[model samples]
Target chain A: MRFWQLASFGGFLLLLPLILGLNDYYIFLTTLILLYTVIVMAWYFIGGLAGQLDLGAGAYHGLGAVVTGYLMIYYNVSGWIGLVLGGLAAMGVAFIVGFPSFRFGLKEVWYALASLGLVLILQKIFLLWTDVAGPLERYIPFREFDPLYMRARAKWFYYYITLGLLLITFYLAHRAKRGKLGLYLVSIRDEEEAAEMLGIDTRRYKLVALLTYSFITAVTGGIYASMVGFYHPILFDGWIGIQTATIAIVGGLGHFWGPPLTSVILLSIAEYLRINLGGTIPGLHQVIFGAILITAILFKPAGIGPYLESLIEKVRKR
Target chain B: MDLLIDFAISLARNVVLGIMMGSVYALAAMGLALLFGVANLINFAHGEYVMLAMYMAYFFSVTLVIDPVVSSIINIPLFFLIGLVTYFLFFKRVINAPPLSQIAVTVGVVVLLRNIALVIWQAEPKAPPFTIFSASYEMGPITIPLDKLFATIISITSLILLYLFLERSKFGTAMRAAADDVDAVSMMGIDTGRLFLLTLGISMMLVGLSGSLIMMYQAVTPTSGLLFGLLSWAIVALAGLGSIRGIYLAAVIFGLADALASGMWDPRGREIILYGLFILILWLKPRGLWGRR
Candidate 1:
């Protein structure tokens, strides 16, 4: 029964853009939502498994977008190469920021603030850095559909790409969770002092989680830049970091499939609200987002993931 | 020689401006100091509340046609209540919950408050055209704006009063004791729940005052939450906990960094310098300037 549920969902995702046939705009929006879903899922590594409240997703994501977009635009790099390079660049930044942060034993709120500051610091630097990026947005060279260059004007292509990335993120998170690394991360999250005393190199494990999460988040940034055909300093949005952490926390802190599920539902609703009410009521969608978050945090502190999972278990037994 | 002298004078001027600017920031951080240091809560929405207070200040000044500073009459009491309300609605639950839940709740409040500002006021920057304190005083080679000067004096005074209250008063002593050991304080027959509420309320009152004082000169947009929130947190991180003087000195350092970065380099680069120095400080001195506990 579980296999069938998983298989059908996969099949549905594969056919989603086709089912919505000519509505390229909706496809584009779905892709954008999935793209963020990738980031939120990747957040499972740091926030969920490792128990760090990292608000620096925006930093890594923006860095990936800038690096990939910059290379593609100026150096004529393939999108695949740009994605890899972008991911690597984000990992580099993760090391630079995370190594010191973990080494200094920064945890809880201090760690969160440090990561939050990372997004703003990077944004400001890129804003003032003129050669690669400046105050103005850098537009990628547009192509109707150059498969060779991996530049496309169609939104469905990007949607499928984001879906692929989401799968990869899911698989990576699954592997990490099931593996030895995940154990250390969980123990550290639960009791850092105890984890350290148990001979776990907590800092190294935490840094590993940071690097993995950052790399995935950056690839999404690369994909985002390509889909939009431009990358700007504003890509380093601290709000994205906050929102990603919010969704992950609300989904269920350490549960797999929770954040991705939550992102799809919440983001689609957010996009819907953005479309319908956004013109007349600018931030109504965000207000709704906030209300949902508070409600979930206050009422379902363990998140809906665990609750839904138990329901699934009961139904399966039946 | 002339170039050297010009540099020196400008540096001196920035130092003075930074100190005054620091005082107002001290008030803001003091609020967080109480909630963070005493109440043992981490509020990601600390900046959002300041942003809300700024909007309130703008609202009162424009609608009531009063000076921005006068908005504190409304801002302080109202925010105190708002803080108490937030305590009940959000902070109360997470006080003992895991840090992740606590952070999530507060970040939710950030999104709610920031977007509410966006919904009601839109994203445009808002400020009164001029206030009564807009005038400047020329002190020979250095010039001081009354708006900032008033902000400094009032901020320092409020902080000092908070400091004395914590030091001299009986209830304040309970609050301090509650900070060190909540269970012990409660066992001694003090109501810690009330102390937490009072800490949150008083801290918010400081946020209200800081917002009103800052509105005398600064224009606020929805994004200012990220700015002031990070700025206030940076001040706290630099100062550590348990000392008003440390917070003041740290805020001044940030102010100087802001002044010099904007004054000497580029205004856009100020955040870089400020946050860069902030991260550097965290790495080097996690205990901060006055971190005793």
Candidate 2:
């Protein structure tokens, strides 16, 4: 029965674009929403599961982007290959930074700040490394339709790709949640000192979570770069990391479906507001976004996920 | 021989400039340190407040046709009130909340304040044309702009005044006592809640003063908050919780880095030098250079 529900949800998303006859604009919007959803879902590893509150999603995302974009632009590598390479690059950097950070026991605000600072450092590096990505926007080759290269003019093509990635992400997140890794992470998050006392080798487990999260986030960046057909140092956006964390927290941290659900709903509202009220008031949409976040944190600190799970439990009981 | 001498001169010139700029940075970081030490609140929105104060400075300066520094008379009191209101409305609930929830609330403030600024200012960098000290004078081969000079003087003076207040005043003792032991302080017939209110107020007042001083020469952009925010954190990390003097020294070191980076290296890479230093410090000496505890 649970399997059927999951399959139906997957099937619905697979046919969403076709069923709605969403134009290119809508597909593009949905794709943007899904891309962020993947980032927030990826946050579940280090943030929700490990309780790290890692805010450096932009660092990994940007690394993935620059590597993939640079490989495709300069080396003529297919984006499929670029995407894999991007994920690997992100994982490698995560390990390098994560090893020291976890070893030093950088937790709470210090860890968050360090991660946030990483985004700015990487952005500046790319900006100054003029040969690869300077202050200027580097354009990727735009093809009318090239599936072989993962370049396409149609928006749905990228939408389907993003959707496929999102499904894989869901599966991975599900597997991770139910596994031994998940059990270790729960202990590490709730009681780090206790977990360490229990001989959990907390640092390695945290690094593993960081590496996994970074790899998935980097793939989203690669897809983003190809879909947009351009990349810049600005792709290394710290705001995206902050927003991803916000969405995850608002969706109810630690829940499998919370982040993705909140991501889609909130992003759709943001897009609607951007279209309707953006021209007149400029930041009306974002102001509403901020209000929603604050209210959620204060009133429903458990997040929307717990309520959702309880409802599902009742239905099962019935 | 000439090129080498010229290099030495430019390097010396940058050192002088960095010290002056670092003074103002000390003033900015001081507020954050106080908020951290006293309130125990990790204010992610510290830079946003400074950004908003810059806007306030611009608003007052433009309307009154006065120097931006003069606008502190209004900005300080106004920000103090804003601080009190925020303490009551937002911060009071999160005093004992976990760092995660505190961060969430403050990050919420960042989003709200930034977007509010965007709505009001429309992303354009606002700079009032009024300048009280627009002259520059030469001391040997190094030149110092009078505007920056006055800004530095004002910054150092404010730092001294705040230091004195913390050392000499009755409430200052109470605030310090709260920092050391909030429950014990409250047990001694002191209102720690009011102390936190004042602490937040004073912290915002420092931000107001720094904003006015910064507006002496620089323009206020929406993104300016992010830059200043990270800068304050970097300075605090470098300074630790030892003393105000540490904050000053660290800010100056940061200023020199800023000066050297922009003057000697690419101007765009300054953040790399600064935040790179911040991460390194976090790894090596998370207790900071002057940290006593």
Candidate 3:
């Protein structure tokens, strides 16, 4: 691992006790941030490296959540087993959608629209599949702290679980970024036809990217369902997908460390702002957040990742 | 027999209403189609412009005590100016950027404009003033709301005018040529930048018109743009990216599908049906029915 990666991991460990010592409110916010960090990392794989912006992560996340919830409820399956099953299920679905879409040569807006349409379709299916999920929220019954059930009353437990998941996600993202897979993804992102011309099996690589990204996101969804303790159709809402894409873009798409860093900072700020302004201003934080997003796009189009890298370089030089 | 009759009647009514509603969607999507087809830029904030126009009509009707019809008349040029300024200030700069950058820029504008609306109008849904024409009118066994009828007529007329202008007029031809090949069009001594500005202005004007008409049927709020934006996207894609005629057809089909689903099933099912159609159509016909191959 690089020095900064080590430093980031060390800093996370050091900050753990400080975070745990905080009040329940702060712990809740921190836990939420960690959850989004996992998601952002997952998004970075396809969005940042492959340059195919699939605004349909929520569909996979929601499916994973529902699948894990059902397995635990009916089959007495452990959360760990549920997580694996959910990941596999998500991979299966991703292949079904991603194969036709990528193979048919849909890119940019066409691909974005198709991916978005996938979310909408999946949402409808989920809604109609009333046995698994419906309009009403499906709650996972609170069992006494059981790792098998993935049920816990303490926020700290959820926090550690999410942090662990975030670590795994980071490892995968790092591996992909430095390997031949990463180069192929970047080639596809920059130019698909050119990548194909260069003897790269563009379709196979894209399929692999989709499967990997979906599996990670599905695991995050399993954790998210356990954290929230309930699953509803609203989980599959378009806003969920939009916010994920927004967070990924804001963090600097394609950067190894940018998404997680952006998630921690921006989501923390959002949480703080929400606590301060939510009651008094009513949607003011969203307004300000939206403004920040616009400014980030306008000035720092490459995202905060590049800026952070340069700043670290300058500090190292000193 | 009675059940079948009820279903048939319901289906007929929904189909009619769907056609009317679809016309509005088609009108709303025209500007988006033009921008995407011609400028090669997807304006994510296109819905915000529609919101602004709706608010403008609402403000004039309520604050200035002007007639809603007259307010729409006034809104046309006002929205045209706003469209021109927005394009010149923001959109013109990123026209040459990559699709991702273009998307990012427009999304930024969407966020900024939406937040501005929240700050200015608050989150409350505002109902625009309407006349007797806004009420429902019954003919034979069918009841058609006058306001919806008026909206439909206005939308269809506007679309007809747009088609004529694009097909018959020199400016429209220049705009189409610029959209097809900007560099080639410029090489022919035509000012492509001017064409873009004019196109943006006209596009926004059409969106404003649609927004004003929408207010006659439904209330407007800051968040109202969300549903409309998504629906317009569905329409644009279903119509195929650049085909205006396809948009109209797609809008009608979507409207019928939405209305029938709601009328026959639960109200929420309407959303499911509409989105289902969007995905199914794209899967079956990726290029859209009327889109150029």
Candidate 4:
């Protein structure tokens, strides 16, 4: 029964684009949902399994966007090539940022502060780096909505691209979940000192997790830049990083499907609120998001993932 | 030779200005350090409380026709109540939770406070209609603004008063005891819970006073809390977790660095230098400048 439920859920998502058709607004929203789901899944590796409360989503995502923007604008590179290079750039940055923090034992609050500071530093750099990226929004040219380059008039091309990214990320996440690296990561997250005492190289495994997470998130950032048709330094916003953190926490940390599911529900509500009441009543959606985050943290720290898992267990017992 | 003399004079001016700004930063850091020492929690929403106090000071001056100086005094108790209420409502529950949970709670508070401020104030930067402190006193080539000077004086006086309170008062001793060991402090027949609340209250009061004092020279915006909040964190981190005197010293260093950066480079350059300093300190000396391992 549980297997069937999972299968049906997957089927529903696979059919979602076809069912929604070419309604640009709904398609755009779905593409955003898929994009964020991929990002949040990447976050789960470092934040969930590794037990590192990293707020450096902006660090990788922003870097990827900037790299992609720079490549496409300056070198006349293809957005598809930018996608791979963008992920690599973000991974490189993650290594640089994560190495020092992990090496020096910056965990929990200290780590969070460092990561947040990293994003701020990156933003300031981009803002001041007038040679490559000035304060102005750099636009990506679209040749009558070229889908191959990701500058499409119709949302379908981006939608499929995001869907592909989501599938690949979800597959990788599943492989990690059932693999040796996943076990090591969870143990390290639960008790790092004990894991180290037990002869696990926590630092190496953490770097691996962080690098993988950064690479995938960077790809999403690259695709996001092309989808949006422009790039700005504000893409590395700390608030967006916090939002990703909220999704990971609320989705049930360490749960493979939790982040994506949480993103779907929460991001949908947020977008709906924004579209409906944004002009009529400003800041209400954010207030709701804040209140929900607080309540979830206080009341449901285990998130919907554990609740669902428990329900499955009860059904199996019956 | 003339170019070098002009550069030296400008550098001197920046150093003086930096010291003045550093006093304000110290005033803010004092509250944060007190909270960390006693509460053992880093309030990311520290700047939101400061923002609230600034708005209150602004309202008092604009609506009730009260002087900001007098209104700031009134803010002490009001903000103390605010702190006490906050403790009971949100903080007390998460006091024993994991560090990440504590952080999430505070981040939630930040989002809520910042957005609420945006809704109420409509995101417009506001300043009180008073120019008394805007006057500058010049000594040859160097000019010091009166508002900054007044702010520095107020901050120093508050710091001295705070020092005396912690040293001489009964509750202050109890608060210090609580910080040393919660179980032992409670075992000594002192109510540790009340002491924690008192510490938090005092911290909030200090933030309140600093916020009001800053309104004379700085404009208060809903988003201004982000920069101030991050700076205070940097100061606390650089100063060490519990050392009050270290906070003051670090704040001065931060202010001087910021002043020099802004004078020599640009405003954006100042932020880069400051955040870089914060990261470097965290890496090199996680125990901070004065914190004992």
User: Interface RMSD of the predictions, in order shown?
Assistant: 0.8, 0.8, 2.6, 1.2
**Model 1 per-residue lDDT tens digits across residues B1-293:** 99999898888888888888888888888898888877888888999999999999999999999999999999999999999999998899889777778888998999899999999999999976579888999988788888899888888888889889999999889888877888899899988888899999999999999999899999999879888898999998889886788898899989888888888889999999988888888898998888865
Q: With candidate 4 superimposed using the best TM-score fit, by how many Å does residue A155's alpha carbon deviate from the native?
A: 1.3
User: Please, what are the lDDT tens digits per residue for candidate 3 over residues A1-318?
Assistant: 699998997797657747568565567677778876787788877888888878778878877888888887778788788899999999999999888777667777667766666676677677877888876888888876887678887767777788888888889888999999999999988888899999999989988888888898788788888887888766665555666777777778787777678878888888888898887876677778777876777678788888889999999999
Local accuracy by lDDT, each model: 0.90, 0.89, 0.79, 0.84
Candidate 4 CAPRI assessment class: medium
| Candidate 4 C-alpha lDDT tens digits along A150-264 | 5777777888888888888888888887899999999999999999999999999999999999998888888889888888998887876777887788778788777778888
TM-score against native, each model: 0.98, 0.97, 0.91, 0.96
Worst 10 residues of 3 chain A by lDDT: A233-242
TM-score of chain A of each: 0.97, 0.96, 0.93, 0.94
Give the higher-TM-score candidate: 1 or 3. Answer: 1
Q: Of the pair 2 and 4, which is ahead by TM-score?
A: 2
Write out the backbone clash pairs for model 3: none
User: What fnat does each of the candidate structures reach?
Assistant: 0.89, 0.81, 0.39, 0.60
lDDT per residue for candidate 2 within A1-318, as digits (tens), equals: 999998998888889788769688888888999999989988999998998988899998998888888888898899999999999999998898889999988988889999999999999999989999998988889899998788898888889898888888888878889998888998999999999998999999999999999999999999999989889999888999899888888888788888889888989988998999999999878999898888888777778888789989999999
Off by over 4 Å in 3: A1-8, A14-17, A73-76, A311-318, B64-70, B115-131, B220-222, B241-243
Looking at candidate 2 chain A, the ten consecutive residues that score lowest on lDDT are A298-307
TM-score of chain B of 2: 0.97
User: How many Å off is the CA of A27 in candidate 2?
Assistant: 0.4
| Pairs with steric clashes in candidate 2 | none
Model 2: residues with Cα > 4 Å off, grouped in runs: A1-4, A311-318
